[model samples]
Target: IPQFEDVKFEAASLLSELYCQENSVDTAKPLLRKAIQISQQTPYWHCRLLFQLAQLHTLEKDLVSACDLLGVGAEYARVVGSEYTRALFLLSKGMLLLMERKLQEVHPLLTLCGQIVENWQGNPIQKESLRVFFLVLQVTHYLDAGQVKSVKPCLKQLQQCIQTISTLHDDEILPSNPADLFHWLPKEHMCVLVYLVTVMHSMQAGYLEKAQKYTDKALMQLEKLKMLDCSPILSSFQVILLEHIIMCRLVTGHKATALQEISQVCQLCQQSPRLFSNHAAQLHTLLGLYCISVNCMDNAEAQFTTALRLTTHQELWAFIVTNLASVYIREGNRHQELYSLLERINPDHNFPVSSHCLRAAAFYIRGLFSFFQGRYNEAKRFLRETLKMSNAEDLNRLTACSLVLLGHIFYVLGNHRESNNMVVPAMQLASKIPDMSVQLWSSALLRDLNKACGNAMDAHEAAQMHQNFSQQLLQDHIEACSLPEHNLITWTDGPPPVQFQAQNGPTTSLASLL
Candidate 1:
């Protein structure tokens, strides 16, 4: 409907962006198609629209279409002489390749992206944003590929880029729906900033506290600019904050406080379910972990199943699979599905410091499965691998779990001296972390070690330690699980039946969505 070619080209680009923002691929496709058609006549438009279409397909999970679009975008970028767009498109394509598990295919695209960004001459600030996105993408690639040394440089670059973006023009933000004449500013740039902050927090690469602080600063900046009403953008901040709060409480040994935070998260999702899909899935998975720690198998199962149902991200799905595998292993199911899933997901067999925590859990849980099945040699191998990986990491719970497994492996192999050494280290690490789950596991191992050695005094001391830790854990839980004084449920009977189910669709759990 635009009369001029320029107007028509701009209209198509804007329409495609709007559709992408709203998660409306069907609505965005025709606009992208028109843009592609127009670009054939005008080569300049071709580079931009082709890149946009590539990203669109990536978002829609249509990898083949995205690859085709990226090929065109790469070609058009060369024809149109735009280094910035070329770098951006290549990075997008590289990430898609990484997701497809095509590890070899990503390096060339990432190298090209780096080359283009290094020479780009757009406004220094805009060029810097593009560079930051690429740097973060590169970091992700390294992390996923287990190239631990390569990650630090990207993290350093990202820190510098964050500082630059903080000083960017105040006019960069705009109302989400009004779509004013904002030439130098793009709304999606802020969205990208939110994502970068999130990745920094999740990876714990460099300056996590600083990243959280920046999130607060960004939120304040958005508020001052009256952009707080942007639901999708606002949801991103809320999601990260909620997750951080829960993790902080759990890590600090305030299990009760952490459980209470889950209630608030549930409330957040109930208010705007679609807006918080990613967070909802993540919360459920965490809740399942909490349930498992407390020996609530039914609740844990419900939570894990729910998490798998709610989201399709490979990482999220992998977490659920690992947890459920532990559950089934404990319940004596021997199909080996969990082992297969972990092997598939962890093809590179990485144990980077950042992911060492997850790797520890995976290895320790599978080792426990082997131990229960009396495969002592297999258990010893898995547990020792997990222990070796736990060194130089800050994951208190995982380190504790690994040590406990190592102790059990030593005890099984009839090495009492080594068993004692492992048990003592495990208990010390478990004590450093505030999680009752690790405390219980460590104490149980200590008691077993004492009993095997026929040391009555050592056994008695361990029993006492176990009693104290158990009491501390239960007291924390009791305080945390208490409902508000005003909303407390007063029962005329002793306790409600376990079979009583809440209506309203079986009480959708955070685990169920994971």
Candidate 2:
């Protein structure tokens, strides 16, 4: 009879896996619940089942239930005297809370997790793994807060921790404790994750070249690993790397390549329904950025709207709303919708955006709206706020955007000298970022300012620079629009279009694109 019960427990796990693979999570959940109920006598199976059920809830974006399950798992682990597994459960819950921007709740939880990792006198490898997880969470928390400077120490510690892990031969060592049997990730995978987080930090700090360097290294490793082993995590890493690199491409004036890579992300997601469900909103957001860059306001609006509808993440929602407001502002209609969207993301009020960069961007959007309404004084107030926040965090992209817009405002107000002062530094910064759109805007303003000041020679030089930027953007736009995948912008619901799926490997090599 006991053997039959064991078979039933094993059967439930295997069956649920099959159902989940087929995208029948509805069928999988009940089976998992039944198994969990029956497996309560076996702590290991019960804990595993609880974690599995929690992951299913997380995948469905039902964070409330997921957190509850994690809480149960944590308490169960504590009762079983498995501090290591308890840390895992608590950390997982912290991640979900962080995702919802419940920072006040997450802060104390992370502190408790930190204490657990410190006091844990378990297998050295497991301790280091828990440390890596804790450091990663800390780094992510700081980065989300737009505290680039504040995150450096934690990042360095993480890097050193991974190095320590790489030197240890813990892979074959079976821990005496059953709960300590789990490995967080293989050394190679952890290395790639460290590179990913480093790339994220570099990108936020406006170190585009550095971001690209790390991305290239990470992708090369991913590609090689995927060839040897077809792990789903590899695909997840690949998609995320491509997502970051594509944004770099957009900023650095590689729109055609960005579009190609966006399709590649779509194709990668299509191979797994879970991946698609988790990333569909983000894919649409990328498409919206492409549409915005190419001046396709209509397509941009549609893409942002779809992303807004699909996403439950508070920060991502605020981001999408900010972008959608920009599209609305550019169209010169939909004033009512724009106002409502702006109200929701007003940084001073509590729309619950914890990211410093996004809050600064919200101010920039507010300034942009004021500028369009011809409220120069109000616009200047908002833009100045944006500059202060961006400068504090070294958010170069937002700083560049705010500076250029302020210069435009000054130009319109006929303060040619002040305009020149704002536009000149903005141009220099944009050129450093190689942000084509901002560079183009700054160059045009420089040309106008020089012309007004009777500096004909300087004016001609500025005009030539503006012309070149325009031509380059125009060509990229045409190339991007010509691609079949451009139609992906129109896709709002369901799976990715089959036509966009890569028949061969990626159409473009990740290394070359980087």
Candidate 3:
């Protein structure tokens, strides 16, 4: 009977793999389900099959079913008295909920997981691994909420947990429990994950140089791992790293490099249909950022709209809507659509986003909209609100943008003294951020304000600064527009552009453009 069960399990697994390979995931799902149904006699095999089936559902983007399966797996692990694997299933479920922006559900689950990891008298390696998993979820949750300061403790614990795991020998002692035989991630993979989260935190905290440093290190480690193992998770990590770095490049005035890396992201995704499907919205969102940087309003709108259509993720949707509203505000048309989007993302009325940064950014967009409509008083109110929120969270770019925009408002009102107060600090902050657009805007405002105040010398210096920023931005814009990949802006529907497809992934040596 045991031999027959083994044969049945192996056959189902092999056939499912074959079906998945042939892109017949639908067929594979039923086979896995049947296998899972029959394996209830063997708890270990049953749990494994459940996980595999859940992964299949996740791959197909049916997160509801995946989450339900994970929940079932957790309960089953509990029934078997394997607290370790129960934590695994619960954490996995929590991750999916986080992806769905179901923070309300995730908070309680993570809390319970943390308690389990703390109290469980398990194998040290397994216990440490669970701590790492629990801490990662906590750090990511805080980061997603844009609470950089709040995430520090969890991140530190995660770093320490990984180090502890690295020092422990995997074969020192076999896990006593069959369910505890698994590792959430190997030491090397866990190291890279820690680095990735650190980079994410640094970026959110406005420590651009630190982010670049960690990104470089993490990417190098990923490259070495890829040589020996071509796991899809590795590729996913690489894509996310590249995405963050590309945004960094744009902020630091390296549009050409960002554009090149955008193509790299596309190429990497093209290698797997699942990767492409999962990341298409992000890819389009990145392209939209590029289009905005290059001053192509129409293309930016198209890309953002495509992203909005493709993404059901709440945070990402809020982000895209905010950006699209900015483009509409800039073009000074499409007032109706802009108003509708503004209402949806409004922080005051059933706001969807929990990220402090996005809420501040939304306020900034509302302020910009008011400014454009010549409602200076109303615009000041919104900008001041943004400033308070950004300052509290150290959202440097938002703070700089808010300051410069407020300076512009003062200049338009002929309040030179007040304008100077805002613009001087804005320029200083922008210079630190190296946000070229904000710097340029601030310099222009300074030049006008100084001129209006009859300070010819100061005005002349501001004029020179403004001219230099203009030439630099113009040069980068020209180079970015000249790239072969520039035509990716036109891609909105269907698969990626055929021309961008590659037989192999791009090189991994992305140096920091900062």
Candidate 4:
């Protein structure tokens, strides 16, 4: 009260950031309000303070207020006469929507952000960091929509952006506090974002070995972040890393190991709720899948329910809905929920063919539900549509799963020739992958189909092969699920060497996460 406006604003700003770093946002909020009030007489400080307050609203899950604050921030940016600040605010708004999976509204803001960053004449690091952040945001946009090829250019641009940031002067410092630096994201935070999006891209692009390799790299980078201890951002990334690691394990058939990893991550989340507050949907979804695999229908339903409540993204929520319908179908659906669920999901795509995965999923699940209900013609049609329209590497496993189900539908209908034909290609696709996890169910189908056609010798041989693959799958669980003791994650081109005996362990680059 005794000091000038600038002095009071400076003191209040630093105190707000210190409180935030300590995870004491309650303390920070009041201090920010006071700072905003004091700086109301000055255009720059006032608008910047408004942005800071909006960030607090975002943290509190009050998105309406956050949206209004952005509007207010825009007016202040005009008053302060800073195009860069206005562009930065637009970028921030885009990022918020991006995280919500609101792709349609983000592209315009991102287009403007790229233009602003290109024209910016600020400190080199700040400009470069903004560029990198935009690159990552673009990559995530395409990746989640299942457009892997679209991300190629963005990935190349991201690498160039990162190199540019690294060449900046080390002696210079940028604002680390959100209250003071409402304009741009930090370099460390930018690096983390890039690492995460790239790893996720690898997973969705059908490169399980590459996924494991990058997850390890991202985890190592997360541990080395130069941020506040247990930073909520860092914690958020930790949850995401663990989720992907578990995903890699599951994709490669390490059910026991994946469960172990999930247990460890659940405990970690319990111990640190700040980071994983929004992460339960994925964790529960994975658990539901595992439960379904082992015929734990009731448990699967419960996990899926929890996942549905936690899911915010439409596509992800759609997947859970599909899975939940499958569980209901398995239960014989005395309640008619499966048909209702199926009718509710629209199988049309508006933008980005990447969403074809979700449409394809709807077809596959409907096919299965039809098969379960003894509607053979409807099952065949839905399964055929799934094979034709759902395009993406990540959904390849689901397609393979649908084909095996189709073959069984043929067998149940006494069309032995059709069953054999369907299974042969399915097995071929599954076995082509280095990790045979995708083809696990195919082996059993092949065995049954061989027996159906009177090839008793081939049937017996397939039975042994199926047993050997199953045993090897279980043995690799422990190693696949655990964190690596080293930095390198190795990889090779083809299916790994097979060992028939239990005496020898798994021998593939995908087996080691290190």
Candidate 5:
């Protein structure tokens, strides 16, 4: 009877396979558990069963649970001296960490995995598979650090590994998402990551259309990935894609439509709590930003506060606190509370936000509050710091925004020459992004400053630019109202997950594959 355990496992595994074929997790899970129990005496198959269970959890966007299952499987492999299974579990764990944006933790584990896989005389396909994943993790790290040069070598190595494993044995597990049964899943995912990183870099460089192009490509690939089993990664990619879209829309003189898009997403999330709870913090934060764009201070404040309350992630908390402080400054209320939250800012605090955006946000909010409270000198200090950091990070949009704030500080302090100088570059940068609102305000200030100094020609030019921006903004509103409301995005989404956002997965980043 004890020897019959393998027979029992095969039967249960078959039933589970049937359930999986139908995408019926409720039926599949119990069967998998039974199979795992039956296969306990067979460590190799038991580990495989645990992995299948973890994959199910991953598909459901329950990455934490997936990690737990993999952990147990790893320990079981080690106990049984199953080197290949241990290495496989480690690779899966590393991928999960990479998806979680825990970059610091990923490298060490992946390095060890590479060593173990290399030394062990295991299945060649599995070794190549681990090698490919390891390279991807490295590539991701380099991209996040904005070192495109460093990524190329790793990418080359990954491609070579893929090319080497041209044929798969019937016993081998296929490497993550294969496109059209020819291209490996890792290859597709690498392309997705490459496009996404390039999009973010392009945005920082103030190349809006280039960023949009890359975003469209990345979104297309992400949609294709949804056809596979893992929705968690795909869902995270969709979030990042939407963030890029909103930013592009806001800057390219489509603020009204951008606001409408975020509003629709927020409303959809609210109606479908499962589709939103995990991403509530980001969704609410985006809504707050839209409200701020429309000068809806009360609504923005509420949305930001809700976002803050929803997230327990330390970095996201910092990001939300900064936004909330901005809202408080805008309302000219609760200065002390704003300062209290701002006090947590260390500039050295581990920020998971893209390219020092969190630090820029902190300084900008601090400067704004100081400006509102009439502490001109303090405001100037913080605003300058904000600009320095933004420029250092090559975050062109934030730098432009900071320059506008700095110009305002100068104008109020009777430093007309400096104010005028600041506004000129700020307007240039704003025009590049086509952020009409910033351009409008900066040009208006320049016009007034020029007129007050009795410079008629310069005043007229500034006045014309301001009027032009106002008209452009009005035109945008009209176009937005005239266009039909249905989403024109052409990509196909996979079958909607029954439990969409579980709120319990690993915290990646605010605007990441979170």
Candidate 6:
């Protein structure tokens, strides 16, 4: 029979590997339970097992369970003088609090962890990994606080770690024998960690283009690995990266590329429909946005309904809800329900993102909804708020749309020059970014504005631009539609019957929902 101490220790460590690999909580729960049972006489071992269980709960977003477990683990860690584990527990707890936007509650916990790590200052092998993990949390906290300057030193430390890892020859750096300590670990894990640091640093600097480059490289590395697809560790990280890419693509107005990537993701979700139903809905919501941009009203409505069917995540639903409201206003329908949905999205609080650019876009989208309702004064207020925050290299679509809205608002107030000035800048920005949809809409608005002002030369120029951009976009959509049935339905015109039917029953009509 195996020694009780040895068996308990091995089980505790092995559960982490099992959790990372198969990610079957039930499969690993037995191991954790056994470890906890055996460690009942040892405070340190008991604390460690409890911490692992807490982490499992955290991964599932069961914050209440995770908090209860962490509370117990902290007491044991304090009693056993296991400072390293204790610090880690504190760090994780702080991070959880941070995620819940409990910023004030986390500072003291993080401070305690930082002090412990600083005092234990031996150059131990285990120290490096712990330090890296702790520093990641620290950097993230600073990011959440919007303190870019304070995050620089930690960013530099992370970069230095990346460089140090790179300097070691590949075979010598990582564990060689499967039986050796920390063996069977993929070197690409380190790459992914460093890539995350790079991404955070870029985000702090407001450098979307730079962030995209690093994420793209990381994704390429991830694709080359032959790891099991069922790993929760992999899936969790993959979803975050996909969400980031989708956000960046949308902000930069790379709509066609974003749509292509989203469709590919949807196809993957379809293969294992039950496992990825929520993720599929996210893809559908994104597809709805792409459809709206192209003026495919029917397809856009269908995609939004598909998204609403997928899940009830409040944050994710906000995007679809707001856009569907815009669609309702566009269709000249009564939009009281749409207004109610928008209020539901941000009810009784400021937004959670806290990003000026994102807020500006949200306001600008609302302006579009207001304009469609012919509420010109309300539209101007929201659109001007959008412009006040606008800078170079932000979301071109929002800026373009805002300018178009301003043009319409000024036209309503009979101020043609002010309208023309706004529209001209929008055209310039749209031209630089190559967003065919925005370009088409902006050009059309300018053409009408020029005609209204009796500028024949400007009207002729605007008409030509509108016609050329719209024709090219329509041609591309037709080409993309000429594909397999499993492919995304493209942005072509009026058909009597909708081709793609939902396999799931009784999806709420998005029109009704909006």
lDDT of 1 by residue, 303-422 (tens): 787777876666557668778888777767645765665564452365222344456567777688789878988877877776666554444456667777778778878898898898
Tell me the alpha-carbon RMSD of every candidate. 7.9, 3.9, 4.0, 8.6, 8.9, 8.0
Question: Following a full C-alpha superposition, what root-mean-square deviation does model 1 have from the true structure?
Answer: 7.9
What's the C-alpha lDDT at position 403 in model 2?
Answer: 95
lDDT of 6: 0.64
Q: Give the clashing residue pairs of candidate 5, or none.
A: 177-185
Q: Decide which is better by TM-score, 1 or 4.
A: 4
State each candidate's clash count: 12, 0, 0, 3, 1, 0
Show model 3 residue runs off by greater than 4 Å: 1-7, 499-514
lDDT of 4 by residue, 1-514 (tens): 6547767677777888788879898999888887777676665577767787888889887776776777667656656566556666777777688766666778877897888779877666667777876787787777667666567888889978886786777544553333224436556667666777777776665566777777787778777873445556777777787787777676677666666566556656665655455666776787777666555677788778877777676777887888888888888944577667777674543421246666777878878877877999998898888877634334556566677888888888888888878777777766643346546667787788789889999899889888988888756644433433100112011121121122254533233556
Give the local distance difference test score of model 1. Answer: 0.63
Q: In candidate 5, which residue ranges exceed 4 Å CA deviation?
A: 1-34, 37-47, 55-88, 95-104, 113-190, 200-206, 220-236, 263-274, 344-355, 452-455, 477-514
Q: TM-score: which candidate is best? A: 3
- The whole-model lDDT of each prediction reads 0.63, 0.87, 0.87, 0.69, 0.69, 0.64
TM agreement with the true structure for every prediction: 0.71, 0.89, 0.92, 0.78, 0.70, 0.72
Candidate 2 lDDT score at position 158: 98
Candidate 3 TM-score versus the reference: 0.92
State, as a TM-score between 0 and 1, how close model 2 is to the true structure.
0.89
In candidate 3, what are the lDDT values of residues 1-514, reduced to their tens digit?
Answer: 7578878887898899899999999899989999998898777778888888888888877899999999999998999888989999999999999887777898899889988889999778888888888898889888889887778888988998888998887666766666665678877888899999998888777677778899999999999999999888999998888888888888878899998899888888778887888899999999999999999999999999999999987778988999999999999979999889899989767778788988988999999999999999999999999999988878888889999999999889988888889999989988876778888999888888888889999999999999999999889999888777788999999877654432255423343232
Q: How well does candidate 2 score on lDDT at residue 397?
A: 88
State which candidate, 2 or 6, has the greater TM-score: 2
Clashing pairs in 2: none
User: In model 4, which regions exceed 4 Å deviation?
Assistant: 1-6, 14-34, 37-44, 78-81, 99-104, 167-186, 226-229, 310-313, 333-335, 346-355, 392-394, 410-425, 432-437, 450-461, 473-514
> Which sequence of candidate numbers ranks them by TM-score, best first?
3, 2, 4, 6, 1, 5
Tens digit of per-residue lDDT, candidate 5, span 316-416: 67767777777777777676876677777645464445435667767787787778888988888888887877776566777788888888888988899
